[model samples]
Target chain A: MSNGARNPNRWLAFSASIAVVALTAACSSGGTTASPDTGTGDGGSDGDVVLEFAQWWEPELPDGVLRGLMDEFEAENPGITVELLSGPYASTKEQVVAGAASGTMSDVVGLDGAWVSDFVQQGAIADLSALMDDAGYDQTQLASQVQLDGSTYMVPVVNFAYMLFSNDAMLADAGVDVPSTRSEFADAAAALTSGNTTGWILPLSLEAPNGIQNDVMSWVWASGGSMLDNGQPDVTNDDVKSAVEFIVDLDSAGVIAPGAATLKEQDKVEEFTNGRVGMMISSLAHINTIRESNPDLEFTISALPAADGYSGERGTPYASWGIGVAENSEHKAEAWKLIDFLMSESSNAQLADAANAFPGNTTARPEFVDNDPIFQEAFDVWQAGYPANEFVGLPVAEQLMRDFSEQLQRVLAGEISVDEALENAQAAWTDEF
Target chain B: MTATLTPEVEAADRQPTPPSSRVRLRRLWDRLTPFGFLSPTLILLIILMVTPIAMVVGYSLMDRVITAPESNFVGFENYVEVLTDPVFATAVKNTIYFAGVSVVAHFVLGMGFALMLNSPILSHRLKAVFRTIYILPWLFTIAIVAVLWRMLLSPNGIVNYLVTTFGFTESSVEWLSDPNLALHAVTFINIWSGYPFFMISLLAGLQGIPRDLYEAARIDRAGPIKQFLHVTLPQLKPIVISMALLDFIWTTQQFALIWMTTGGGPINRTEMVSTYTYKLAFATYDFSVASAAAVIVLVLSMVLAFFYVRHQKSRD
Candidate 1:
């Protein structure tokens, strides 16, 4: 043998080159070979239609129910297939933004209700009412949430309404009943707060934008202050000012958690479930988790407390996670089929119960309510809840929510007066509009 | 050698024999080969770093709402708006406070650790172990550190548990909540996670310093404190300055730790420039304003770097 053949280094190099080639070959072939049958077709041969549904669920939440729905849909419709793309809820907005920017968005997307109006304004989502009508689906049976400005751009399969959740045991221990008015609520919170526990806790973290918006907006609405009136930012509304004053009072009185401004919804929920919080405004979806966290903890759901001497419907801010077809999608018909299947009376109830939320279909609501006895009151409160599609119709809605959160934090921290904070926030809102 | 020649001709002759054009071309090719090899990376840097920065500068001059389809040129408006915005002022103030305090804390703690680790009494193996242990925090991801610190500082968390258990105070302190303390709490976490980088760098500098200096100091009967002041500090000046400069830059740009923890809240007490810019971009979807803020941050960093480099050269 020649010197090169005898050399171990030469042999090693040859082996490494072979290995690299093999690895490259394997990597290139892996996806197609391993999941040949499960591959997403690009509306090509074999008469296959593949639709990608992007959502924040199917990752952390129990996905068995969603998987069953997809399987049933696929079985019923042999030619069409549904692919689930799951990601963390925190990254939902970013993912959608990037997807839209790159023009590679999923065919069907489960958008946060807050994002729906913005998407509609940007023409990022298609009008789905026509599709719904063509399928002989009664548009009236759809949740009021799906209809924005008398037109439906999405279909909410399930929903979670933000409402007041009280630790009945803690309230009783403090010698206070579930407060139905702002003053009573404040009194209850102040009375209950002692030791390591806070009287009233809501995740006020500006980092958790949705959490802040859901909890804070309920107060403004309950005080009969519309966030936007006639497409104008309305933070200077007297009712909103009073709401800010109430929040500041709560903070100064030390009824709220010490670092409540930095806590997320999950943190606040953890505190509540662990018997540390007396009262909190939370979503109807958390009932099961709260029970699981502490079986002995007695809690009651109630409508948001109205302002004193005010007579209006209680502010129940329920957000529905709805499915919308991307405007740029190629397989719009297939995407609608998947959405239609999920929102079908049968699938809607199952998905809602599985996800621990309310059904968006009116037909499915009764069955879902019947199944979950604990969430019955929450459902009823949500039934009379403020309409979802109204406030967020403005393009400035998100900015308005963000300004409210930041300014509210300032007010709570006593860095600024309620009037000043509200005025500054309103100024920002006005400048933007 | 006897022939008188002009300076240019003489220099050219001394360089080498004037080659044929083909040979000159080959020589030029040889001279340019290394740069030719490096051009790809240079191009990548230009494409990746320079292009984006230029785009940001361009965007700063536009009226770009992130998700909106339309963006008209609005020169200097974004910058004017951002500068006048109270939140931007708060962010700048918070960034300075965070970076200033955290950098000082890191330096002090890092110097202490480095001194201890560099002590002559410890075996090499023991020093290695201690070094590894100290750098553990640096090895952990910022996300993990943020989560860990959050859990520790939570009202019902173990830090409170220990505080109550040890009877340090009757009540549990809200470490990340109080506006007065939230910035400090986040600074403490930043210092804890970051000091290791300084310590390791300073320790390496210490090891490189000759033992003769310390011996010379001892010969003059200089005590430990005096030696540290005169010998150790002077010897470590270059490393200290370099580390301090790097730490200042890193701390100023820090986003995740403060963002994941307080989110510039408790009324924007801990709102750093990075977090504020992120909020403007992602949360508010006002990328033009964010770009303006970013340009300001970039300019501040460049000015600091320029002064640092100039000072370093002056010292040399």
Candidate 2:
């Protein structure tokens, strides 16, 4: 053949090889698929069923109670299988949202407490009132915990409160006592702060909306302010302005960790675990993690305190993670069965103990806490607690919460005054709504 | 020819019998076969690129939320909302600042490294070692780079430790937390991660330059600066412009690095358009607004690319 004909053949071979290499690289780097069965099993026996469950807790507690319950459930109902989907907690919500968009949401999902309403409003989750009644579960008790707008949606798995955790040694070394009021708290924080050690830390980073919402709202709630007055953001309230001013004062006083503005929940816990920080406002879910990391560190817990001259009762932020069925799930029956198993007394007790969290079931809490003095005290404080913030049911809740966080950060950074920050936040809330 | 009138002679005298239609078609097939082999790539590009762009355009005009099935023809309302959002303005401002600083820094640092490596006084062994070292950051995934830098730039981290230990500064710098410094800090990380691409690319461009031009410049009594200006830069202009344009697009769309490090934080000081769109779509489930933002970014990039291509054609 002439060179002209031969050249085309060479180019063809080159292109083919390049295409093959590109495809191979893509396949190698892309995500792994679990099984051919997405929701339902390949046409099996008439009784066969497969249910996909997506939860973030798997990575945190892979071999713990939830896994055990699944095993038990599978054994109890032969020919039924559970497929678990999990990833880093940070990516869980995004993953679920994507799954919803693609119509591949799991039969059941473990959703954040703040996210349940958003999911329900989007029709991503199914109303479980009928399922709850069929299972003989007390809807009134569980529904109040998981329902939105008088409809059952979630079956709570773990209930916990956000409160203050202090490193005892740091406080003792600084000669400060446990604070019970906002003024005393500020004074204690200032007294405890020393060279190379901060007195307090919270996840002030705007990226951690949950952390920012919970930690900042504690101050707001304690000062006779609520994030929502009649389900609308009350950022311009006098009490909220005072709360913002107090936080700004703390930052100006240099009592917060140097990088507090960018810290995440895990970062704050890490600092406390390392025994470098005096105090942290965190949740009970991290107690096991902190203890596991620093076995020798001494720490104490306290109920969130109120602002000076405030007559309101002491309260904390209560939050939970719950299981719910997807609205479009093909295996809704099997999913409900799994949810029933998880919320059962035995499973609740087992999970609460293994996961180091309070049980969602009102009666199960006493058993779950089970004579642990730390949890007993937390339970008492939690009984008076409320939703951390009112953004839970608002439109564009996450963005609203983020905007609130950003304004607060601006105040802390001394770039804006408390009034200006509140005004800006309120403007954003108004625009978004 | 007139004397050779026999059948066999006539057959030889005439042009060899034209190949049958099948043979002619086979030759034509052979000529077109390369493009046939390229069809897979062409199809893949259409599927991944063309389809997504079309979808974004379609979605940008609708009032669609990913979680809900309800949608309506909004017709530019999403775009108006996105443009009017105060946060969107912040995002646009940040993106421009980041892209401007990052691209210029990458070019300067990358060209410097490429020139140093391309120097004749340096032994090939040393040059190879230095080249490898400079390119190492590019080899890492952005996730790894973000996490590494986050740790290094933490208040109590190695960067602070070194500064304080050496008495360079009296206090920790909160590099990722300071409102004024966070955007610059993220830009610095991006510069660190990105300069190596330019280095490798410009180095290849440098190597392709004919030695005669430099020799001629030297003979003309041209100084190092003069030689670089007259010979090196003129040759590198096309490459430099193309790379700079691409870097603008890539840096503006950067997310994982900034997301993992500062998260557009310290009061949205480092909020880029990409992260803002991401937050809108994922956090707020407002896909329509997010799609509008994405379409705007796409148009900006396409406009830059179009100008570059036109310039190149004009030059050619």
Candidate 3:
């Protein structure tokens, strides 16, 4: 045998050795577990702390604003440093969920009401009321606390009410007034439907089926009705049935936008921004997005149209930017300080103004409400109608919305009767509970 | 002093002496050489693949995993729950339809385009241009493909405009929202995005086919159709079977495109096993049930893989 054959084997062995070394080096460099004691008392021997604050809020706010706020907090608390880990809402939720499962959650975390119950169940979030008591923070100053089994797990940092948005030009062209009642709203929508445009946009994409909560159930809530009776699924009740019937009627009238079953919230906002739709029920958070997308588009804000002949204070659908302290965090006191700073009247107002939302502190009022008439009108609407979102703090809330949306899609498609659809939804929601 | 060695010493030197320690060590190293080359891959597979799979299997047999502090083994209860759900049934049916139709369409389109690109009459430049256009969809990431198709298939999108302009329809058609059309619409999108992969593979296979065979067929008075049926297909059979099986495995696991476009909506018309499992895990936080569903999907994939391996071995 030639010595060359033996040489090749030697070379192969050498290459394998090099590869093993490289792989070991790479693994050593990349394999970093998030420190369990990241926010603990022993985080630094010098009595300094580094708090990881994971949120979706920073990305949504104007660039540098959230970072600036964190900088201010760090300046005020000399020994404490805050780190911001931010991403879009969906990715943030996924990250937080993974972190919670692994016991590596950020010390201070952004929360959604839908996630509160699950987090509470897992004991992933700390009891905010207890922390507040330890910190001597006034709980009464907070607008609302999301409680699970009488323990506060999340506190609202800001609130965004979903309200009806009407394109002024479209409404004017259709000669329809801003709809205050369901019947008039349908008529206005019908009138607006002409020449490649629809009257209303309802996004019911099951991917993010908050539409069932924000768009469909808003009508039920507007009539001061509940989709739950004593914290159980009441989707088959008269209020929900009426709401579904109203939506089906709209579908039959062809006043609702086409492809609504596949449409998402951003798509609805786009349609409204383009003036392709006459009206939609949307969040106050989208106000700036619309203005940025189409500055020339004239629009007005109003309360969601109430069910006709329901003479009572309407309930407006609202979503919030909620804050919590991770239970795994050893620096619960430090985490609460961050929350307290954010929930302070001035800071909350500043955040709300920048985000075009309502302050979570009861006495805090966003400055945008004074100068922005549309915001003012929305604020007034919010005041007239108490914020109503029954799905909040419910177990598997998003799943509940999805179940309802799936059944509602069937109703809209005329594949099943409204009664049957509601019954099906009720059964599904019951199973989750 | 030139002392002469004794016959006994000479004989001892000639004996094997039970092989030296150095020789034994070399032999042992020779035996372990192949494993040394394979150790990195084996370690990776064990860590990345085997461990996660084992954990998921463990989760499949438990209740309230990942969410609850303490979980109890429920045997196959989670699996039973998932299997009995009507939505799971719908997901299975839809996944079959999606993968079946996608694979068939992908093969047909791919083979057709490959044949066209391989035609001798076409100039090389023309073929290059056509190839670029055909392969464009494959170049895009799945996310981009999904978003592009979404825009094109929107109710008021250009597709609708063209259809209406050509008098194919009276008004804008709801391609994605209509339950009847949504499954077909998404399958069409998948087919569009996936065919390029097959086309590229089959094109290579076509170029590798012996030109002398075709010339011999021509001399034998074999028509183009007969040549294709008798010669072309047989020549590409191995590649075709391999590509189709791989595509089936991939299409069955399609999640991103479906998730981005329809999200298994319009009354569960486009639900696939991937999306259903995802919903169970993420949307409802039912990790136990999701793991069970995942295990079921793994079994199905393993079965497909078994046949694929069998086919490859037969070809070899």
Q: What C-alpha RMSD separates each model from the true structure?
A: 9.6, 6.4, 6.2
Shift in Å, residue A318, candidate 3: 0.7
Residue A157, model 2: lDDT of 79
* Candidate 3: Cα lDDT at A299: 91
TM-score of 1: 0.85
What C-alpha lDDT values do all the predictions have? Answer: 0.77, 0.78, 0.89
Q: What's the lDDT of the predicted structure labeled candidate 1? A: 0.77
Model 1, A1-433: lDDT tens per residue?
A: 8887788654554444333323322332211111122222267477688877778877645747677789999999898877877667766566775565445667888876667776776667778877776776666767654556778886767777777889888888889999989999999999888888888886777677555567766787765566677767787888777777787788888888766767888987888898888888888778878878889998888888988887877666767777888887887777778887887788888888777788877788545577665677777777675643334455545655666677777777667788888888888778766
For candidate 1, the per-residue lDDT at B90 reads 90
Better-scoring candidate (lDDT), 2 or 3: 3
Task: Provide the TM-score of the second chain in candidate 3.
Answer: 0.92
DockQ of 1: 0.19
Rank the candidate models, highest DockQ first: 3, 2, 1
Per-candidate TM vs. native?
0.85, 0.87, 0.92
i-RMS of candidate 1: 12.1
Task: Give the higher-TM-score candidate: 2 or 3.
Answer: 3
Please report the candidate that would top DockQ against the real structure. 3
DockQ numbers for every candidate? Answer: 0.19, 0.29, 0.31
Q: Which model, 1 or 2, shows the larger DockQ?
A: 2
Q: What is the interface RMSD of candidate 3, in Å?
A: 8.6
Q: Give residue B1's lDDT in candidate 3 (0 to 100).
A: 88
Best by lDDT: 3
Sort the candidates on TM-score, descending order: 3, 2, 1
The digit string of per-residue lDDT tens for model 3 on B34-125 reads 99998998798668666777899999999999999999999999999999999999999999999999999999999999999999989999
